[model samples]
Target: MGGEYELNFSCMLKPYKRVLLKLSGEALMGNLGYGIDPGVVEGIAGEIAEVVALGVQVAVVVGGGNIFRGVKASASGMDRATADYIGMIATVMNSLTLQDSLERNGVQTRVQTAIAMQEVAEPYIRRRAIRHLEKGRVVIFGAGSGNPFFTTDTTAALRAAEIDAEVIFKATKVDGVYDADPQLNPNAKRYQSLTYGHVLAQDLRVMDSTAIALCKENNIPILVFDLTVRGNIRRAVIGESIGTLVGGFCEVS
Candidate 1:
């Protein structure tokens, strides 16, 4: 599909009014293994800029696995809720860094938090978020639903549903879904596309069960793609085939 619609039997369609992109904080870690990497962030922002140039309304929710993992803190004897709160704050850090990078590149960005901190960022309000989208401003939701024990994956589903996004784009290191961990299983078969029921029944690790169920219930598709591949974000947004589409009936590759 040469940047134009193709009538191929396996072509992916892009009729979405809006899209929610879920970025893992680890994706921004570059080679440091911790904290934000300016180069990586800029590359990611550049990809978003390309998508935005296509007139797509984008909303992003970034995880904080780059800064802290609540599960890890719990193993260290911290209260789960306290540890989760710390994780939420970590996400806020990523959201700020992303917003700063996008702003520096002339992309109007907003950082909304699940936990209220009026002086720093705007509190997440669905209507306000939609308004921002309508105005072509990219919104980054941070702080993970203002609750504990829920992963940022769940936050992406919840916000995507609330915002009426047609699909949830889950960007990861891998380009698509596989039956087993690609790192562990050298012969693992990669799925070109998968249905919601198939994905749930097989217990795929693309997203948490709660998030997958939420997206399934709301008829929102999840596109799992490799964002580390420069320009994949724009490709995914503009209907390029770079990942596994998780929703609807299973289609053979």
Candidate 2:
């Protein structure tokens, strides 16, 4: 742990100027089985605040799995399109809650939705979103491309491309990607870095195929790291070799 801290500190020399963070709704659940956990959201907000303090522009795309999962509902016999629309609304709720928490932390924030809801959030405008980040405001994108078929992962990739973020930070429960599920396989190997083709060929599921292909086409690197660890966001932003980097190389440990 001490050595890890040293490495993280030493890598602070080259922080990214702009980044897109992908946070799953389940991550906001903490120990709860469902719904948002205020404490967890507060902790995440604080960490993002630290990154903003470093002058790094941050944009977030949050998932809605905790509140509602469209794919599951669709599998259960509901109309796929309707279920997905409901899922999008769930993401909006999450975005609002996150916005509230971020504002409480004194970090300026903007909630932009692909599906326009004038009463609550601004409509998704690429230029305006970029302007918000340039002015030191954290932008939260919700509603998943304003369509039923696309997942939030795809939305993250799309928004990242539109804003020209330097990198995409995929915050997950696990520390990094592995050859097998570490929980089930004691001998599972963790990958330190991977190439785009490798991820798709192996069906690693780092992100959906659409999202991965989009990032690949846009030439954006993705760093998959453990968000549960305190300060991991800032650590990643500072370029610490702390997660599975998916772009331009392949290595496993």
Candidate 3:
């Protein structure tokens, strides 16, 4: 499974041509309490490169909690809007780091920020972003929907719909969606498949309400899987059935 042939084999089995990947800033923290972990970023980049090699188009929406959480700041007394703007900047920083790592992995990438910073990354243009993906360049979206009070999860769903992605791949610490926090409740049941209505009604908390609703309205599917598992990203892309599939009715293996 470590050779070029295997990579090609996986690519050949992929059911999706394009996808939107949602990365939480907290996941980039590795074991640290805050900030990006270089090793973790590099590993993620390597995993992305594998997907890219398999000819799947990838677009990413990254959160900024590792550096700053606007909601937390606002709750602590900063103006909500201002705190959220600062949080957007944090995402741009993470986006650049991800771009750098992807480039180092020999994968072409683009960092498009919703907030303009010409000196660093390109401003977000939906058409341009789609063009990059078509060219096999990884498009990394930063800044939370270019507005305050919006989570990166929403950004991922919005971008996925805009780009007409087949699915939204949510990489989380937990392997999949559960009836309860799996770590806290060992007996919690993991759902292999779920409907959008069921998730909303159950208050799954898998993604923010705004994000989940957006996907539901657009009929986009979501796959929630563990990012900690080194090859899970590539596995999910190639339809290995390794996650919790939400929104669409699909047979689960």
Candidate 4:
């Protein structure tokens, strides 16, 4: 039995060697209404560890919606730039928490922030981040481009391009991109595949326009999948076709 397990494991082939995982801060919330949930974070870390064991270079871009949402704050009367900066800081916090969970799972990780926070994390250095991934360490990117008015989605696309990742796995609550909100529309259709032009034209909201544009320009495919489903990360890395794929092709099912 042990021999068979080892043989099968060794024969497993992943589709992409290097990839970026975009995780929303809300994912860490799990069943909670706010804040990070330890159980949820640990579960995600375990799955990431499994993928890393497969020799895939992983980079993560985490959002800060759970702790703080800049957009909402701004709409409530706060200065837009100030709210966004606070949101960026919130992302750093989430990144550190994720790094801790990942390390506890025996996966080496580095937290790099766009804003200067050398005391807690390394500054975002593209070459250094790539080098860490090459060395089998997971690199977590925090802060949204170190600028205001940009979502973490854009940061993921930007960082993925900088690190030369082959694909971007966007882990979301929904399983895939839908023509309408599945939560609201019972007949909402999920897209199996999509093209950059279609996504841009239809404004599917898979990611922000800036993010989609960046991915399109860099030719990096973005796979939108449900993070709540355990093992989905590994499934994505192995090309199991569990999500909506956005790239140069278009298909619907």
Best by lDDT: 2
lDDT of each: 0.86, 0.90, 0.88, 0.88
Candidate 4: the clashing residue pairs are none
TM-score of each: 0.93, 0.93, 0.93, 0.92
Error of 3 at 226 (Å): 0.3
lDDT of 1 by residue, 2-114 (tens): 11111131545565669999999899898897898999999889888777777899999999999999999999999999999999999999999999988887889999999
lDDT of 2 by residue, 174-249 (tens): 9998989999999988877677777888899999999999998998878899999999999999887787877632
Give me the displacement of residue 192 in model 3, in angstroms: 0.3
RMSD of each: 4.5, 4.7, 6.5, 7.4
Clashes of 2: 0
- Over the stretch 1-253, how does candidate 4's per-residue lDDT look in tens digits? 1111111222222478999999999999999999999999999999999999999999999999999999999999999999999999999999999999999999999999989998999999988998999999999999989999999999999999999998899999999888889889999888777777778888889899999999988888888899988888988898786877777432222
TM-score, candidate number 1: 0.93
Stretches of candidate 4 exceeding 4 Å from the true structure: 1-14, 249-253
Q: What's the TM for model 3? A: 0.93
lDDT of 1 at 194: 75
